[model samples]
Target: MTTPASHLMTSLRSGNATAPRLTWYGPDSERVELSGRVLDNWVAKTSNLLQDELDAAPGMRLKLDLPAHWKSMVWALAAWQVGLETVLDGADADFLVTAATDPVEGRYDAVIAVALPALAMRWPGTLPAGWVDYAAEVRSHGDVFMAHAEPDPAACAIRAGGGGVHSQAGLLEGFALPHEDGARIHLAAGDGLEGALAGALGAWQRDGSVVLTAPEVELTDHLLATERIHGN
Candidate 1:
């Protein structure tokens, strides 16, 4: 059975796979771009890591403690692909994905520390014992994802900060922001992770793309013209 997550991935990889799907601008003039195929590959690897290494399965809650960066977006997509409920808030979760330098342990079953830099092959600093270094381990996982079991459409996909929930089937339709078809939308990091995710989903669903900028990055006229951004 094809779940919503799987279907979305399929759509993402269908046409113009080499076209830029997500572009990110961060502090210090950092720029990163991911094509549709590349984004799918990252999601696939992360999903495999979650399933094979972390033993994640449908109904398990995975909390995201990272910022609204491109890597954070990939992690969310991977969790959804593996049928894990992504918790944006709340304390009780089986797995915690964070970029924090010193993440508090003993709260979640597993803590995965992520490196925010686009080209980071491993964590920059020493990770606490027992914590998983995402950059170090994720590359060793398979580039393709195969679900151990199909996800239920009625299963919760996102747990919002306000304690609201969106089902897997309803996630895109209910939360995605409005956008014109094939438009290149600019997403501001100040909108937060949830808003960014929603906007990205909306754009992808409409065969559009997103240019996401970090909070510290300014949206200048030059940048907009260079990226060919249609709207924000």
Candidate 2:
């Protein structure tokens, strides 16, 4: 077995090749954060496919266009096996097609994305023409996925539910503050405008949940959900 020093040397020598990470995910997840959950799953799949990708091609990179709801610990490890970078390509296909235009972009011949069917339909050309259906493949994959890279970081989440959400004006003020200066924030106000803070604008390490009214982030209520009770 490799000793601690051996492992440390191995990691230090080729850290870039073995360091894992979650490049993208959703914002303001109430519990474990649905977006973070998907990220975790993706990491798992990538890790499982890492050796496979490596055996097929020694030096290659994987570029991902992940939806807001895609996060998996597995995806990160798998990336380290090769080199995977995460990118957020809005919620549309028009942009995605354009993203694969250049040679560097072309290098990302493979793709991992959610809503593959919808995306496939939107593509001007054909499905799997030069892309790998990430979500679809993941759904078909086994539940148990292993890792080959080191832990980048675990994701934590906080959300302000709609129970306290009320209408005064016509906008969504969101329920949580973006947190301290270094806080993670994803600002999104979708559908039900009565009151909803779509996401955070910073990273995913922010704490507590704060809910504002319809027109102002300042004029809102306060709430915190615990795992046992206050479940979403």
Candidate 3:
């Protein structure tokens, strides 16, 4: 299997276009982009962190709270960089608040959220804080991108849902495949489609591309009501 770095370098050399990647902002700001130099630096920093994690703990689960925007590609890639299974919860911060408390899905390391969507974030850690700015930290890292670890698919990835978390065989089945046409995006369940930077967008960004479903407004509204009623 070709490494992500080699694949990214090939795409960059070819000058491909990619979907935008998203990052959660402060409590007030909406999602923001982490492309260009910002993206380079993130890839550089997170790449090292991921390698360190793999070195310390070979099979640890990683949880990310991301939205469906082009910018989300960065975090997804970063997660894959460390071989962490990015739990795909098609809900927002409000939804996570309940998931975290529930007996089944409550053991996440961290979740990513932005603006109003962050209504689900009552949890805190290095990933998400009760009252903190993640973007500022990304900026503090600077413009140099660095890393040495390669993508290891043999590692575990768990997709958590209401009943219980399941093995991410769907991932091993192949989410991105190299084709004569180019990098192809594959998604089985509808949940994998959001903010997945695939096809043209991914090629340009030198990031993994995605073919995801559009966002759902009703779901977000439902999370809000649940949070309001439950007092999250």
Top TM-score prediction, candidate number:
1
When superposed on Cα atoms, how far off is each prediction in RMSD?
A: 1.3, 14.6, 10.9
Ranking, lDDT, top scorer first? 1, 3, 2
For candidate 1, the clash count comes to 0
Deviation in Å, model 2, residue 166 alpha carbon: 41
All models: lDDT?
0.89, 0.30, 0.37
Residue 63, model 1: Cα distance from true site in angstroms: 0.5
Per candidate, the number of residue pairs that clash is: 0, 26, 28
For lDDT, the strongest prediction is: 1
Worst 10 residues of 1 by lDDT: 101-110
lDDT tens digits, residue span 1-232, model 1 = 6666788888888788899999999988999999999999999999999999999998899999988999999999999888889988756899999998664845777899999988889999888888999999999999889999888888999976567788888878877777898989999998899989989988988889999999999899999999999954
Please identify which of the two predictions, 1 or 3, would achieve the higher TM-score against the true structure.
1
Give a tens-digit lDDT track for model 3, residues 1-232.
4334334533443343233323332324343433334454555455444444323122444444444433344554555544455556543211121222223344333333332233333234333343223332333443333344434545444443443332323342234333323332422222442324333233333244323223432225553343221110
- What is candidate 2's TM-score against the reference? 0.35
> Compared with the true structure, what per-residue lDDT tens digits does model 2 show for residues 93-206?
111212232332334344444342223323344445555444445444443343333322221111124333211111112322334532322222222221222323112223
Model 1 bad stretches (over 4 Å):
103-106
What is the TM-score of each predicted model, taking all chains together? Answer: 0.96, 0.35, 0.45
Q: What residue runs in model 3 are displaced by over 4 Å at the alpha carbon?
A: 13-42, 45-58, 90-132, 142-151, 157-173, 177-232
